[model samples]
Target: MAPPRNSAVKSARPVLAPLSIGNATPSNGGTPFRKPILTKAQRKAAPASGGIRRYQKSTELLIPKESFKRVVTSTVSDASKAHPMRIGKEALESLQEAAENRLVKTFEAAQLLAIHAKRQEIQQEDMKMIRRYQKSTELLIPAAPFERVVRELAQDLMSDILFTKDALKAIHVEAEDVLVKIFEKAQAFAIHAKRVTITDKDIQLAVKEILQ
Candidate 1:
């Protein structure tokens, strides 16, 4: 019995070459090769620092969050004493933000006032000026409060006086004008003394001059 020569022929098996670190390539051509990730210590050793380092906050804000929160709580508590209402967290936060903005603007206004007046330092007198604050609303005493104060003062001089609401309003308006004038005069005295804050003596002198 004879066998076919083609049946005895064997297929050649391909041999894989040993992989060298320098010349080794990935099995899949479609997938790109990626570099090994470094640890924190290795990251610091890298030429470009922080290549694999975790991110962290660099610094804190100028005003502490807890302190600001406490301030808001105190303000809310004080307001609640008079109004007797509960303030939500959102409302309290809004109030805190508004207060911060107002204070920042106030300091900026003082800086501008000082620059305009050619002064190196901002004074209490600078804050006293309505123009410096750029406040649209006028600061005025209420007629009722003004009437009550006037009635109390009258006890030392004359009594049995009744004031109409209109009369009391007029008096309040006039008194506000006079008070502003007196304050300005006191500020002038402070300026003359080269003082930033107006002293009691300066106020007394201003009042005396106004009465005279």
Candidate 2:
């Protein structure tokens, strides 16, 4: 007839009340537990000093996607006798990647040319030389006075950096060697493409292959 021992032990244990937000009060008589709200000025200033701010490299496309797509569409239409062609998103992206890569290759070639002449800044002649060199196997040489142009451009591009005359000459020699290698690879690419004319695309492909 007596109650079980377990029941007696349970009844003896102390009970705690559930916490209620409305009933709770701050220790310092301030507002009860609530998130701090920022003013407009405070929000604006937060990024200046707050550790919460984050920075990342830009992800914007170098080539305008819409414009490139339009150009591609136009080219395809003209080539296919005005037939409608819908390029998939993946294909467009791939084409854009290739075009961007080609542009980078062209710039790199020009830069190499400039450096080969001991110039830090790329000139119009440098670009022209790269184009000419890519198109043919002929010995392509810049007509500019190499030493003067190199000194001027080097000073312009590296105003703060110091380069000894000997160092500049060494860089020029190294750059020329690299340029010859690039030209040879580009020629090979043109041959592989089965084209007598070495186009910019061939140069780009060659650069890609060489890099790989």
Report per-prediction Cα RMSD to one decimal.
22.8, 17.9
The per-residue C-alpha lDDT of model 1 at residue 192 equals: 69
Consecutive 10-residue window with the lowest summed lDDT within model 1: 51-60
List, residue by residue over 67-97, the lDDT tens digit for candidate 1: 8878767877887887766667777566666
Q: Candidate 2 on 169-202: residue-level lDDT in tens? A: 6666766676767777886676466554578887
The local distance difference test score of each candidate is 0.69, 0.71
Q: Runs in model 2 with CA error above 4 Å?
A: 1-60, 118-121, 137-212
TM-score (C-alpha, index-matched) for candidate 1 = 0.37
What value does the lDDT take at residue 138 in candidate 2?
35
TM-score of each: 0.37, 0.35
Per-residue error (Å), model 2, residue 151? 42
- Model 1 gets an lDDT of 0.69
For model 1, what is the error of residue 20's alpha carbon versus the real structure, in angstroms, after optimal superposition? 80
